[model samples]
Each structure stands twice: as structure tokens, then as C-alpha cells.
Target: MIVLPYLQTPRARIRLAEASDAPMLLRYREENHAHLSPWEPLREPEYYTLAHCLKTITEGREYALQDRGYPLMAFDPDEQTILATFTFANVVRGVFQGCHLGYGVAERMQGHGLMREILEPGIAWAFGELGLHRVMANYLPRNERSAKLLAKLGFEREGYARRYLRIAGVWEDHVLTARICPDG
Candidate 1:
């Protein structure tokens, strides 16, 4: 099994999602449904349940073990409530050596630079430990906050895609951006 080390900033701590986090994960999703819906895929009723969270956490752990993905959860200093999540998915080995980045923060936690704090070390781990060459993050053009965040994090605009993803039950376009490994 891949044992991930904890990553911390002054305001929060990040670690791989665990089965034990199911209840809080479910609660986080439920509480932020409306806040996140515009940026995420439409969810079924079961998606907010404890069982779903358990299954997802289990699968995420398995995927991490296989080096296919890293699903991380960031929590407040109390370490009980989930404040954000950052997923490094679609990890490609060989010539690609890259992954897609997806992330979200609690509605109440926005505007605090918490996502930036969470991602800095996470991306560092991807480059330093995982040896990835590039990390891609995409956002809707209308999401100025996300655009700004990605840019601030050194992700350059690569291109745009039409109907790039199905979010909120509709196909939405996305602005593609990527950051290459600084040491590469």
C-alpha cells in the first residue's frame, strides 16, 4: 500500500482520503452541494450517502496504491471536518508522466488562499515524489476565481475545449491549462 505523508500549511492539513473519513466526506458533500453544483457533475441522491463516500474512499485508496491516482482531502486544524479536496487523476506513466488535477474548497472556506496552500505542497509531491512532468487543470471560462487561481499557480492557458465536460447535467466548455514540473 502507498502510505502518503501528511501535507500541512498554517491553516490546514492534507492527506490521502481514508475510509474512516466517510461520514465527514458525506457531510461535506451534502453541505456544499449547491455551492459546488455549478462546477461539478450532477449527483444522484446516493452520491451524498455515507455508503458512497466509503466506496469512493476505498477506491481512491486502491487507485493510489496502484499509482493511478491520488485523492487528497484537506481539513481544518481540528482535522475533523473536510475543508477541501484535490484529486490527481488519469496519471499516465511512460512518455506522458502527467495527470489531471481537480479540486474544490468548502464554500465557507473560499477567499482564504486555502486552495493555494493545499495545492503547493501537493503539486510539489507530484513532481518530487511522483516524478510527473506536467499537471493539467481546467476550468469554465465563467469561473473567474478558478481562472485566477490556476494562473496564480503558474498554469498556462493551453487551449479551450468545446463541450469539454458534463457538469450540472449540461455539456460545458472548459479552459485548459497546465503547469510543467519546474525542475524538469
Candidate 2:
């Protein structure tokens, strides 16, 4: 299990998801349904309910404990309001030392540099605590913000993959990017 430490940015707090966070998470998803739906997979009708949220949280914890993945939530430091979520999945340890990242910030919080603040520490922790050598992030070519954010974090644009992901019910092309930890 990868025990996560609380990470703080200028305006956000990034930490692991717990069972108690289900309601907040569900609320965020509900509010951002239209905003996120375009970039995410289709969710079950029940997936946004409290019960589903709890199940997700519990599964996230289990994955983290087993070092299978890391699911993190970002919140406003002052208000303690849920602001976004991110996950480090496809974790391959041992000699491989890599993981794939997935993240999204609320629409209202889009231009606040919150993503960078959240990603920097999270990336650092993956490299430091997880001893990962490289991290991969992918985004639709049209997602300029995500592209810029990844570039700002030292990720190099490696190439493009067609039909790399199923987004909004369609297979979409993505720009593959990677960041190597200098300390690794």
C-alpha cells in the first residue's frame, strides 16, 4: 500500500479519498456532470449515488493499500470544498517504475492554476514515495489547458495515439506525454 501524505498548494489540499468523502465526491460529480461527461466514460445511472460513491471510495482505498493505484481528491483549503479529483493508475513497479495519470478539475476552477498546484506535488510523491522513474499523462489534442499543464510540469510530447481512449462514448485520439523524475 502506498500511504499518502497530505499535500497542500496555495489554494488546494490534495489527499487520499476515504469512505467519509463519498457525499462530497458525489456532489462534485453531480454538479460537474455536463462538464466532465465529455471527457469521461459514460457512468451508470446509479454511479452518482451515495452508495456508489462509498463503494468507489472503498475500492480506491483498497487499491492504494495494495499499491495498485492512487486515487486522490483535491479540495479548497479554506472552505474544505471538493474541487477536483485525480488518480495514478496502471501502476507498474519493480523495474518498470511507471504509472498513468488521470485528473480533472471542476469547470469553475479551470483557470486558477489549481491543476498545476495539485499535479506538482502529486507527481513528486509518485516519483519520491513510489520510486517511479516516469509518469505518463494523456489528453485530447483539443484540451489545451491539460496539454499546457503537462508541458509546464516538464512532460515532453512523445507522440499521438489514435483511439487511445474511450471518451464520451467514442474512441478519441490523445497526445501522449511523459515526465521523467530527475531524482529517480
Candidate 3:
């Protein structure tokens, strides 16, 4: 649909969500709940509800407008089903013009190179149109998929943090990685 400027892949079109897209987000959340639980924060029962998804979508849109971040959805050609979600969050400017990258793919779309397809341009937009210098992404040490993906995307290993983030319930260690703007 070309809704988002300068964001697309061969298999997916990346765009921010509209309020009406809440249903799609809800469906994606529900379908991938079990699949993504290990990597994400614990979700309360209400988090799966339509109203909550709508609220989240609204907040995400607000964040985008504020230059904070946005939940970029990678949708198939139909644009009805979500392929993946890439969020560039916690934007900090001034000397450190950077943000955090978080993402997840649909259960069915895993192992199909869909995430890379989405992120390649997503990061490019972050560094180009957004005019950011650095983009950081971290992952649980055991998440081999993430480790491989980040390495493939040229995110150099910066360091490791103990008890970095609370995933599911307990604190988990993370391997921090970052990519700088190539043109800089």
C-alpha cells in the first residue's frame, strides 16, 4: 500500500499501524503468545484483549509522532497478516543519536528470512531519514537466532550485561550489539 515512506522488502511491506489495525495486532499477539513468551516480558491476560491492542496501537502511533519510536509492522502482500514487528525505541539525541531495536516475527514466518528483510530497510530508515548515528539491539545469550541475525546485520558486539532485562518473569542476561551509520 506504500503507506510508510522508504520501508519495504520483497516479502513484506513495513508500515505503522492505524487504530483500525488493532484487530490485526491482537490476532498476531494471540497467535504468537506462546511462541514469543520466552523472549518478551510477561503479558497479563488483559494484554491480549482488543481494547488493549487498540491502546497499544494508539500509543505506538503517538510515539512515532513524537520521534520516540514506533511499532513497525511487516505485513504480507495482503497486508492483513503481520509478518513481523520491528520497534526502534528509546530514541536519544544530541551526542548520542541512537535508539534501541526490538523485534519479533510471526510463528509461522520464522526461519524464512523475513526479519532480515524487514530490518534491512528499517535500520536504514533509522540512520537515513531519522538521521540517527547508532542503533542498538540486544538479545538473550541463548537466543541463537537473534545472535546470528544481529551478526549478519553487522551489529558489532559491544559488551554483555548481567540481568539486563526481565523476560517472561526473571531477569536475563543480554549480549549488547550496536550498528553505526555507515555514511558517517
TM-score top scorer: 1
Worst 10 residues of 1 by lDDT: 1-10
Per-residue CA lDDT of model 3 for 92-159, tens digit only, reads 97899999999999999999998888899999888888888999999999999999999999999999
**Model 2 lDDT tens row, 1-184:** 4567588988888888777788888899899999999889888899889999999899988888888899899988863578989999989978888999999999899898888888989999999888899999999999998889999999999999999989888999999999998985
Cα RMSD for candidates in order: 1.1, 1.3, 2.3
Residue runs of model 3 more than 4 Å from their true location after superposition? 1-6
Predicted structure with the largest lDDT when compared to the true one: 1
Ranking by TM-score: 1, 3, 2
Per residue, candidate 1 scores C-alpha lDDT tens digits across 32-123 of: 99999999998999998999999999999888889999999998888899999999999999999999999999999999899998899899
Off by over 4 Å in 1: 1-3
156 Cα displacement, candidate 1 (Å): 0.2
Off by over 4 Å in 2: none
Give every collision pair in model 1.
Answer: none
The lDDT values for all models are: 0.93, 0.88, 0.90
Per-candidate TM vs. native?
Answer: 0.97, 0.96, 0.96
Whole-structure CA lDDT of model 1: 0.93
